[model samples]
Target chain A: MALRLTGYDEVMAQDLIQSTWITAVRRLESFEWKSTLKTWLIGILINVNREQIHKEQKKKETEQVREDTMISKSGTVSGYDIEQGLIQLPIGYRRVIILHDIEGYQHKEIGAILGIEEGTSKSQLFQARKALRNWLTDNSNEE
Target chain B: MKSKMNHEELTPEERAAFDELSNFKLPPASLEARVINELKNQGLIEKQKTMNIYLKWTASVAASVLIFFAGSYWGKQSIENSDIDPNLAYMLILHEDESFRPGDPMAMFEEYGNWMQDIIDRGIKITGHELDNEAVMVKASSETHFGEEATERTSGYFIVEAESREEALEIARKNPHVKYGGTIELKPYVVR
Candidate 1:
């Protein structure tokens, strides 16, 4: 609808028509065929978009790491940290304690399997673990 | 997962910023439907990949046709009215005699304007530029030049369009400079 006229009648609705034509023409002209004999230009643009997406993915991965390592006391420990911490624990001690306390097993199995009183087996193990934890912290402070 | 922001433990800057936030307030209920309708009317905005090549091609062809006809019309008009030929040139060489002074433009100014305008109107003269009268001649190792003392330099020149050598001379004869005891040197100007 945009007509490019060399000359026009000034007496008509010239200003209005000319302004409308200019606006429409400009918008239409924006859809230019930017093709070239060298196809590498378009290839580079695609590569740039790909690089941007890769960068965004890397950023998201970093955000995930931050989420896992965030310092909080609201019982949000990462599984990786738990695995590493459990490795430092004595094999039988933590195994028995985890089965009884963490896994909510009966003390009869703690006694039969690990040789201790059925009722006292749970509480005694709990107290011993608390004492060990305090001793570790104290030792750390001394160091 | 990391915990969301706990406002109770906010830093002073964060707490102050949070305190300034307004309570939930709804927009005017009527505006929501209007916005939805507007969105529906426009639909999705998208970029076009290609232009209508057929339309542009047609326009180009039409432009070529218009140019051809328009050029022929003007070409014919100039040939009939002005007797212009590409190979021809009109040279008007100015000559002043003993009675002519260099600085009396008032006597010839009006007549020169009308004279030059007539040539332009007839489409005979495309353009002309006036030159300063300074001529140099090398005599042995020294050079003799036109200055205040050496006043024998040709005055000025004009180029006009003509059909033949005789017609060019006729143009030179009618020049305003010739009326005041001045002669014109007509010559053929070959343009490469």
Candidate 2:
């Protein structure tokens, strides 16, 4: 889950996982046990990933813009695989799709985990699927 | 490829892709060791010391015998001196509420085990049991009710021998329950 959420950046995913475990241990006292332990850990991972993204955004703002333009112009992601296509998605779309589809979390659960409304989760899933489909189809045509 | 797929529905190809992604992948072998080491460094978990099998067995037997004799001697002394034992015993009532976050079950067990082991190593007589959710209340009028507030709230209890109330309070203060957002009620046993 951490790897998928971090666009398969192994180093970043490992860092996120390590941070998540430490945070979960330190903050275990605040856990109400209302949800399963797995959900709580995932919640912590998502938060850690969000923080990482925020920090990276400041450093890579110009680089991100250039990459976005290249992607738009090429009509396909740098790689043709579905996982690669997932990396090309906006963070919001990627998260929703990964959690809802790949992780098999319900919209309500996804909303609670992501701290978003159920409607928002549903809408993002729709948009994410559309985007992923378009990317995959365009890449297949290129092949 | 479906040209018009609803938000609620996944196309066959999408489902297959999702299935492929969902297939569990084992993380790096070193990650587990790294996590455990980090946890130990943070003092979140105890560093398990490796001991020789025969030596550990011998030590375990010696400790068991010592604890048994000590407990028996204390038990007899407490009974003979007075109805209320001279050695103060405090009941640590664990109350669980919304804030109590008992993280991983295995980790929680290990934590509690380490805590009780520490108390035992200090030569303090301690005993405890986790309470079950099932509880019933019987009124004086013979009316019985299930799930009383006290029974529902009280998750567990521990009785420990202490030299003084202050010492008992210190023990309670160190309990993982208190650290994990659970309330601990310390009460001295009274003789009727």
> Residue B146's C-alpha lDDT in candidate 2?
44
- Candidate 1 deviation (Cα RMSD): 38.2
Top candidate when judged by DockQ against the true structure: 2
Per-prediction DockQ, in order?
A: 0.01, 0.12
Top model number, lDDT: 2
CA RMSD of each candidate after superposition: 38.2, 18.3
Question: In model 1, which runs have C-alpha deviations exceeding 4 angstroms?
Answer: A1-143, B1-86, B101-107, B139-142
Write one digit per residue (lDDT tens) for candidate 1, span B1-192: 112333123235422332222111222333323432442354311111232322232122221121112111111111123333547866677766576543223224334545654554565743332334556878889997775344455755556678778767766776666776667788777778
True contacts kept of 2: 0.23
All candidates: TM-score: 0.30, 0.53
Candidate 1 per-residue C-alpha lDDT over A20-107 given as tens digits, one digit per residue, 9 for 90 to 100? 2223222332322232101111122222323433554421211211222222133232323232232334433444443443333456
Write down the TM-score for model 2. 0.53
